[model samples]
Target: MTGMTAEVMTPKEVETAKEAAIAPKFVTKGVDVYYAEKQALTNVSLDIETNQVTSLIGPSGCGKSTYLRCLNRMNDTIDICRVMGDILLDGADIYSREMDVVHLRARVGMVFQKPNPFPKSIYENVCYGPKIHGIAKNKAELDDIVHTSLQKAGLWNEVKDRMHEPGTGLSGGQQQRLCIARAVAVQPDVILMDEPCSALDPIATAKIEELIDELRVNYTIVIVTHSMQQAARVSQRTGFFHLGELVEVGETEQIFTNPKDERTQGYITGRFG
Candidate 1:
């Protein structure tokens, strides 16, 4: 008989191996988008890992946001927009006839570039999703959801005393955070941010970046950002889009320091977006 020694793995090594074995949260392949005869994205394919931040970077009108919108079927709202390809969430086709758009959107929440809060109070803003989704059967549950959501978004301290105030009354950053809390209230599995800090000051941008970092521990995050620095800062993986196609994708450090594609290097070096 051949002798074999049993191998023991450290906790960190076991966790790493488990993560490597887990399938990506989202798997997109050969995605193409068209709007009124204009092609917006061409053969875009990428995998969004679970519990990680993936940032899509590209110049304006380069289709990064368009591709992001496809993940949640947001493009379906446009009358002339058409998307083709496989967008799988946990191995299930998101575009299949059986998929519920409302439920999908709830599972994959979104925060826009601007802070677009409702006219309702802060409490109402955060509670709306739970109310609509029937996640809370009573007032106490709804209140708890609001409190926990705000806390997770890092806005609880600022808004605890102002729960009854209009959500629009908050400042730019606060409103954005409130919007994040609103999204978080539903307990989504994924959060998609479209240039989430574009309209904010540097300080506010930093806060949002911090929140993004913290949120990834519980939810997969995909952000479309034009700022290379922001992408480098907040994302564990970075994908670069150019001329409606994904040029390269890799670990953030490699994408920034040693790009595999010249186009990515050019864009990173500030030659041209």
Candidate 2:
């Protein structure tokens, strides 16, 4: 299990390493992945800093989703996915055999491109994770978790009066927010969103962007977005992946304005995908 171990260092040790040191909530080093002998990600190395948003942008089939799935070992659910890399969270290697995928998922949550709320009441959806994880002992405790999670997801104000309504009965934006609340209920250390706004309207997207900004105060966020503007608005840093390779990575302003790599420049300038 070539999990993210070497990419990590103690905070004390990291402090002396250099100013460029990541202080990462998670790190990936020399990561390679393949599905049935077809490579999906190649020699990918990057750092995901704590309390910040990192956006992965590129053309389709660039392996952004693959890389995101590797963070929580979600790819393990696929039989053909062969992952070779190190993914570290809070200075610990996460791909080791000893690592618990269930628990790992609890710490590292994910939101999909489409809003796929469970077929249950809104309150049930938000409380599901805590129930499975045994995070709450009684109704009061569960209510607090649900309330806080919904508040963090920015849905409390809209849905507090109708917590018993079916989650799937909500509009697309509300459903998406419910999913966000569901993910938050687990109190994840990091959250991965794969094109979370693709199915949303501009207004809904803006709300999510705002929620993401607020989420940065407590949780590290990584989003795979196709909208360059959304990336610019919601992320502090951007990583551009191309054909399964991470072509460039840097501050969002530099990557969007004055990219260092020719490929990056071309992609940003709309010359090529």
Candidate 3:
């Protein structure tokens, strides 16, 4: 044993190392939100993996949307809102003073509860983000970005011939897709959707669900949905929130079928929200 050594790792240890190498896209710990004197979220901690759909399912006002907005600092728009805790994107603090809110929002785009496309033409609706973010330099570049974004959003063929038409002129589903296209045009690493299909018909909702599944291949998606069925259909991971706290989180299948927490089981069984 003249200063010689041999090292070996078991299969379990090797797997643990591999998992540790791939960090989560977003890591939130002890996040609390306040609007004036009222507390909205309390000590919530969660890790959102990259390129996966993570659904937040709970009753209305459970702070699901509040947590989603925290990812991009959307709550800052509210005069009385204040957020505290650590939120990390790519292991960097998103809530730090050095973080640029505008750029952070560009990296983490949002789709609202309703389809709120700009009043501009469909092309403009998709082009605006790229233009403002300087993602496109010239006419041809802008055109390409708009086209590609629409394609990613699964609305290209439906609206290609109507690029110049007002975005608001499209049907509810198409308009929602247009809003998604707008968010994609910014080339975000993450997308936040808040009850995106609540206003659409069942058919349209199905289409949006399909698009969400497809988009997860390239972008990390966090969706706040009231429909447990939608969450089961679209997400790989699911988190149950109740009364401003995260009750449980796990694989979508496991969460719905065999939740560890009784609260999760009760909610899944329709006992209570």
User: Quick one: best lDDT, which candidate?
Assistant: 1
- lDDT of model number 2: 0.90
lDDT of 1 by residue, 1-273 (tens): 001114787898778657644779899999999998999999999999988999999888889999999999999999999999999998899999999999999989999999999999999999999999999989998999999899999999998998999999999999999999999998898999999999999999999999999998788899999889999999999999999999999999999999999999999999983
Per-candidate RMSD, Å? 6.8, 5.4, 7.9
| Number of the candidate with higher lDDT, 1 or 3 | 1
Off by over 4 Å in 3: 1-21
What global local distance difference test value does model 1 have?
Answer: 0.92
Residue pairs whose backbone atoms clash in candidate 2 = 2-85, 3-86, 3-87, 4-86, 4-87
Question: Which residue runs of candidate 1 sit more than 4 Å off their true CA positions?
Answer: 1-21
The alpha-carbon lDDT assigned to residue 66 of candidate 2 equals 93
**Model 3 TM-score, 2 decimals:** 0.91
Worst 10 residues of 2 by lDDT: 1-10
Listed per model in order, the count of residue pairs whose N, CA or C atoms clash below 3 Å is 0, 5, 0
Off by over 4 Å in 2: 1-22
What lDDT score belongs to each candidate, Candidate 1 first? 0.92, 0.90, 0.91
lDDT of 2 by residue, 1-273 (tens): 111225777896566553433478888999999999899999999999887899999988999889999999999999999999788987789988888889999889999999999999999999999999998999999999999999999999999999999999998998999999999998898899999999999999999999999988778899999999999999999999999999999999989888999988887788993
Error of 3 at 16 (Å): 18
